[model samples]
Target: MAAIYMRMLGYTVTLTMHGFNMFLMNNLLQGPVMEDPNIRTFSAMYKRFFTVWTMFLQIFVASLGLTSDYLTLKYSNKKEPYWLGVMRSMKNRLFAAILWPTVFLVSTFFWSLYHYDRSLIYPLFADKILSSTANHILHTAVVPLVVWELVFQPRSVPKSHAVNVAMLTVYMSTYFFVMYYTYLEKGVWMYSIFGIAYDTNICFPLIISFIGVMLYIYYHMQWFLTQIVWQPQAKIKM
Candidate 1:
């Protein structure tokens, strides 16, 4: 019951944050900023952001699987084990196992970088782009929601840790390559750090190093959470 409500609350908060982000961008970042070709580009837009993408998927999966939880909570009539039914679909598991970790990983890493240097990670008009409300929801509130799921609805870290890391690498590499080519073509860096002057040789290596460390930490952290949450209570046979 508590977990359900907590998930519901998280969904509500995420939805509200998304709405607030749109309102700010549409209303505040008007005139020239909105009309900037660089900003208007797909890579330069909000959806390109890892934080925004994770939140978007969280809301998307939550809405798509709403009926699963709804039906589970709505009745107690069927009793053949929850896993025996459609509740245990691959989509649900992937969303739970892969998609969920991606969110936490992105959230955790972004916050770490933000703390180290806000200017590098987020720019001057970040508030106008994502809004303070949305930022907190993505960076701060995301922690609690992640902890809530970890504490209550924990899932194991996937055994294919290498595969997971490779997928994440591919994601970052694609972004980097696209942004790199775009910069070559248009003389604009999608991010401040992506410019040829500073980021030429060392930038990618540094980012890759960070990703490797984070992936290692993610596996261990998730393993710990699963241990703490999913351990069976000792039976009292007295």
Candidate 2:
């Protein structure tokens, strides 16, 4: 249910951005009237307004996700049995498994930052490379671990492959929408995969790399769910 709400929120924001972009692009292509200073002033105002508005919206959404994550973790940790007991245990194990890798990634990232040139680092940092990496870790690693434990790890119930694919599609779409707004508003390209400068050839490879990372996280979550959640539940039932 939380996932569904998050997906809707993201989709609505994406559509709003697309609408605004279309309006701007159409007016720009209509050709300027040089004699009309008012028109130019209006255009400038519109651009500034939208830029600030979009930035606020993006920040709001990101903060909401972070808040939601905190709430979810807190609620889950209460052990109120919203889901099956086995599922809860599975989630716990999955969360534990993710901690080590998350620590490793953050440690490596910060260590590399120490050796980076200050001038070079500013652009990269401003482009949200660090924040994006953290966001990706949360989405690809942390969220999945939580979902596996909270949602998927109980009842000996097998879900169809299609269901899994649909859920993933929704998740990725939500993620991409948030990222698009983050870049659009700030004019900062975080990952090379989404960089406008690159041709499809280069961009595609980066996208593949991104996908590979997500898949790795997904499978790892699945393994943890199965081993820690299902196996132990099976043993108890035996």
Candidate 3:
């Protein structure tokens, strides 16, 4: 009952955050920024951001958690295990394996680079375009939501770590391909780091390697944290 209520709260929060972000983004798109022809040409790229991708994943996992929890709570004595199993599997595989790592990476990387030099990941001028509230919701609030899910929701290590990592790789590769394609089309890199004048050949590969390492680290971090949460409970039951 407690877990169900907690997840319901999380789902509500995730939905509200996503809704506010969508509202802010819509306003930005339809507002004066679009009046600038140059900005308008690149406005479509906003959807391609990793933060945006993780936000969608967050909402998905939250919904999955809420549904699975609700069913479990309502049908505790019933025998409808199939759908519950499916929902839990999807939530564990997608949320624990992929979403956590990606969200962690985005939040950490964005804020770290943002504070060191905003121009690398996000431009200083973009502050005027994107409100601080929206920016924090995207980059800041996301971390706590993932952490809250990890801490509050009982989770097991994903059944197939390899498959989970493969899906993450595919998602990441698609984004990289998009960035490359955008660069080819517009003659400008989506990120300033890639546009650096020196040693441009090494930039993309280096960044990709770094991201791969970070994601792997965060994946293991999630596993370790899950153990911390569930291991003691398992022992007590035994």
Candidate 4:
């Protein structure tokens, strides 16, 4: 069965270790490879890709998710309205637990698709810089964890769509702000698609609109999958 600690602890440890290994490999063993003369290895190391940011955030939020789930597991089994029970069984707080880790899982899917042809989006240098194990950890392993939550950890849809939308807006806006700031500071886009969009006028607006529509669709889609399809498996049946 999919348990929160099992799901999140695995993600947290695996990702942290992977990142540590990379840090060691890059800094100590061989040193950072400066692919672009314009971009410093230090800036490029921490502030390179959406995938890296997602990995960091997913690990962070999923740790919180684990704590939320632990509280619920410990307290929700009984009738007392413990604080952890609220985090676990409540509609809105539970949604926050589900949504944040999902922000990265969703990005993982897009990253795989975008990297199909490195020349088109990711570029060839990425392959040399990041090992296949690192790539798979970031791109492939995340999908099953997301699916696990959908199948085993379902929760009823939150009462207010506004709250869900606001949560998503704040999270995604933070990512965009980071992306924009990184670009301004380093003269590079985290992903090639963004750089291409920024260069064109019409495409930029269309891209923004497209992302908004996708966010709406994804939120509802997750709700439908959990609330309708997998509701029976939920620990606190709604």
Candidate 5:
């Protein structure tokens, strides 16, 4: 979905995919190692292996998605059975839901990077454009893509509200900590809303509250996609 949107928006799909992938690998692996000495040695080794694995995986998925889209369009007139049409429509919608948020997040990050000093960005690799693009593909594209597939795919049962909230909390907390670390290390603002002049003495608490609110919004969006879009369609008879 992101690829399609990017293509429609006249951005290079390859570059967008590459940028997102690099972002994920750097954040999940290298960022932790750099911030915590306890994680440095083993985490560094894991990061190298994970980077290679992720690169291959992203390329394969991107190719597969493009091929699938091509085939779907190319054979659209060839009269599919009712079930096939239903399946195809569901697949396409699911792809769109997954793709849209990724593009939103990646575009947001990229725009932020453009406005702020590179040094101030989290997932340190994003500081360099090439590295940042790679990071974006890995982090922004691959990780989220896989996550959507595993956790939010059409056949998967929706998680309970408690579980959903817990998962969302953990995810937001990790991002918040990483952002805080990035701010401390660079002594510059990456996100203008949380700029240094905001007075950490008061602003820090507000920032934390803001993240909680954002997480709630994210969860609600996920719930709406799963419950309102995918599941009802899945239940309809072809």
Candidate 6:
């Protein structure tokens, strides 16, 4: 019983921390960060970026997990509620399928481009609006946080790979469409690479295709990791 309670405490603390960081980041972006003239100028475009979208999603999931944890603890002596289990299962699926992959991909690609040439992915002028701390929390800290969730939490893997794949497909496809739509409306590409090669070269499609493939790779990678961490027969369904 003590061990179980301690585990619950750990999960709650982690979720609270994650949720709080995201809330803080969102607050800064919506308030002080947006106050800057440069940020205000491209606010709509910036909001449409993949990082921001993922950040929002992560925040919501963390909040949901925390809530479910609280309810499960409150009813510790009773039969676990079905809805609570469903909430957790939903959270697990989202984490394994969408959140983990997107966060890893964003952090990896952002830092790679940022190091090679900051101007290409994250230009210097942009630094004034997004401080290094907030920047790292968005692009760097999230990687470990998601990994921590996978390792520490006991979660059932969703049985339907097709459903997971479909969810990811819709998510990436929507963002893909939004990328071109943003260019048409704002006359600016979300990533500079698109602006450079989208019209003349095959690089744009190739990059998008590569990202699509990587998403699936990351998805399966999580399943593999989960299988190693949790019981094979009971936890992992597919």
Q: In TM-score terms, which candidate is top?
A: 3
List runs of model 3 lying over 4 Å from the truth.
Answer: 158-160, 197-199, 232-238
Off by over 4 Å in 6: 1-38, 156-159, 233-238
Query: Tens-digit lDDT track for model 5 on 188-224?
Result: 4444456753676887687568546644664456555
> What residue pairs clash in candidate 2, if any at all?
91-149
TM-score sort, best first: 3, 6, 4, 1, 5, 2
RMSD vs true structure, all candidates: 5.3, 13.4, 3.1, 4.4, 10.3, 3.2
Question: 106-223, model 1: which lDDT tens digit per residue?
Answer: 7776777678876666766564456667677776676665555455453554545565556556665675666566667867655554443355677767765766666556645765
User: Weakest 10 consecutive residues, lDDT, candidate 1?
Assistant: 229-238
Pairs with backbone N, CA or C atoms under 3 Å apart (clashes), candidate 4: none
Lowest-scoring 10 consecutive residues by lDDT in candidate 2? Answer: 120-129
lDDT (tens digit, per residue) of candidate 6 on 82-109: 8888887787677766888999889988
Worst 10 residues of 5 by lDDT: 3-12
Per-residue lDDT of 151-218 in model 4, one digit per residue for the tens? 54556665666755776777777877887888898677766677888989789778767776776776
Off by over 4 Å in 1: 31-44, 79-92, 95-97, 154-186, 196-198, 233-238
User: Model 5 scores what on Cα lDDT?
Assistant: 0.47
Please list the C-alpha lDDT of all candidates, in the order they appear: 0.59, 0.41, 0.78, 0.59, 0.47, 0.74
lDDT of 3 at 207: 79
Would you estimate the TM-scores of all the predictions?
0.71, 0.34, 0.89, 0.72, 0.41, 0.84
Instruction: Kindly provide the TM-score of model 5 when superposed on the true structure, using C-alpha atoms.
Output: 0.41
List candidate 2 stretches off by more than 4 Å. 1-159, 181-186, 196-200, 205-213, 232-238
lDDT of 2 at 147: 41
Model 4 regions lying over 4 Å from their true place: 1-45, 70-81, 86-117, 232-238
lDDT-based ranking, best first? 3, 6, 4, 1, 5, 2
